[model samples]
Target chain A: EAGVAQSPRYKIIEKRQSVAFWCNPISGHATLYWYQQILGQGPKLLIQFQNNGVVDDSQLPKDRFSAERLKGVDSTLKIQPAKLEDSAVYLCASSSIKDSYGYTFGSGTRLTVV
Target chain B: SQQGEEDPQALSIQEGENATMNCSYKTSINNLQWYRQNSGRGLVHLILIRSNEREKHSGRLRVTLDTSKKSSSLLITASRAADTASYFCATAALSEKLVFGKGTKLTVNP
Candidate 1:
């Protein structure tokens, strides 16, 4: 089976600009998650989706960050008016209760704010 | 705040030696998972131990969870150069989110 897939392996944008990342989880997986990982830090959950419905978003910087998992198989995370602090690796992961032992993560999108 | 914190922020050891990393959490958890990240890439799932499990093993990896102590330890037996990577432990609380620790950087020299 294929692992989670993410697009735009790398991106460079200016402050106050906007960028969007796309993710496709492994087949038949119903739970999706978005995480932000700064250098030298563990990945932090930005949002989580269970079959297209949100399970958590409390950590998301709602004012600038938005995400959606439409149709329950794919997801997209957007950052508007990107800030220098928003520059980090965006990772997407998926899991299921029946297979909750672990999660499958994407290679991630490395965003550079200039 | 419920994230796990790994001890010995970094570790350096030689191949054929045993490597151990410890993690502590502050809240109750259903399970704890360990992951490995090479360089700045995505993480790879390693081992998962439930709160009820005291010890588990997979190949060269051994994980021990102590709910009473709210801590866990991962031991890689006879580690190899390929085992060099950043290791992280994540705790899954009631919120269903996997809170992760800062991670431990391990360097296995051959």
Candidate 2:
């Protein structure tokens, strides 16, 4: 089984610019999650998708951050007008709906907002 | 918001030594999981202990969960330099959402 895959291992953008990160979850996994990890801190959940429908997005900054998992497979997280504080690692993970034990994570996209 | 809080924020030990990290969380949880993240890499699942189980082990890792105390501990025995990484504890509440702790950065010197 392949691990979760993410693109653009690194990204740099000026403040107020827009950027997007993509993720492809493990095969057959029904749940996907997006998390933001700041320097010197743990990863925090930003959004969660059960198949194609969103199961949680309470922590996502809807005003600037938006994400979608189309066709219940690949997911894209976009940040519009990126802020300096948005410079962090964006991680994507997936797990089996029947097995809630743990998640398999992607390498992540390191975003630098200048 | 983060639910679990890891203690000792950092730890340093020599190879072949044991390193123990602790995590305390608020609210009732259905299960607790441990993850390891190497610098510039994604996290890898280490172990999971359910509310009913008091202890579990995987390879050289040992995890103990005390629901009565709302705390858990991860012990790495005979740790090697390769074990150096950030360790995080995530608590899954009754819901499917998992809340993570700030994490403990461990350094195993060879």
Candidate 3:
């Protein structure tokens, strides 16, 4: 099966700039997740979508980070006025079931905020 | 927030040796999963052990879950250099939220 797909494998932006990352989940997946991973740290959940509706976004920094899964297929994560601390790998994952099956992840977008 | 905590932040072993990583978490969980992430790559699911199941095996990977102790262990037998990567343990709670821990960096020297 095809794996989750992400674009712009790498991105570099100046602090206070805006950047967006796109992700296409695996076919037939109903749940999509966005995670942020800092250097030498574990991936932290940024947001979660069950189909097109959000199921969780408690960890997302709404002031800067926003995510949307439109049409319940693809998702976009955007960071406005990016901060230096926001430089990290943004990962996307999808699962056939919510919290039941294993997730299939995309290679991720390595965002560098200068 | 992170739920699981992996021990021995790093491990270095020679090929053909065995490497074991342990994870401990608080609160009750519905299941626990193991994932591998190669440098510059996304995480790949390695295995999953439910709260009811004590253990599970996939290929050369063995995972043991002890709910009573709130801990789990991942043993990689006959490790190969190709197996070098970061291993993470994630817990799925009743709320249906999956949380990951600080991963263990494993290096298998050939």
Q: What is the DockQ of each candidate?
A: 0.75, 0.84, 0.82
Lowest-sum lDDT 10-residue window in model 3 chain A: A95-104
User: Which TM-score value belongs to model 3?
Assistant: 0.98
Worst 10 residues of 2 chain B by lDDT: B91-100
Model 1's CAPRI class is medium
Q: What would the TM-scores of all predictions be?
A: 0.98, 0.98, 0.98
Which prediction has more favorable lDDT, 2 or 3? 2
Interface RMSD of each: 1.5, 0.9, 0.9
Ranking by DockQ: 2, 3, 1
Candidate 1 per-residue lDDT over residues B1-110, each given as its tens digit: 43799998999999999999999999899899999999979999998898889999999999999999999999999999999999999999755679999999999999
The residue ranges of model 3 lying beyond 4 angstroms of the native Cα positions read: A98-100
Kindly list the per-residue Cα lDDT of model 2 for residues B1-110, writing each as its tens digit: 99999988999999999999999999999999999999999999888889999999898999999999999999999999999999999998665677899999999999
Query: Native-vs-model 1 lDDT?
Result: 0.93
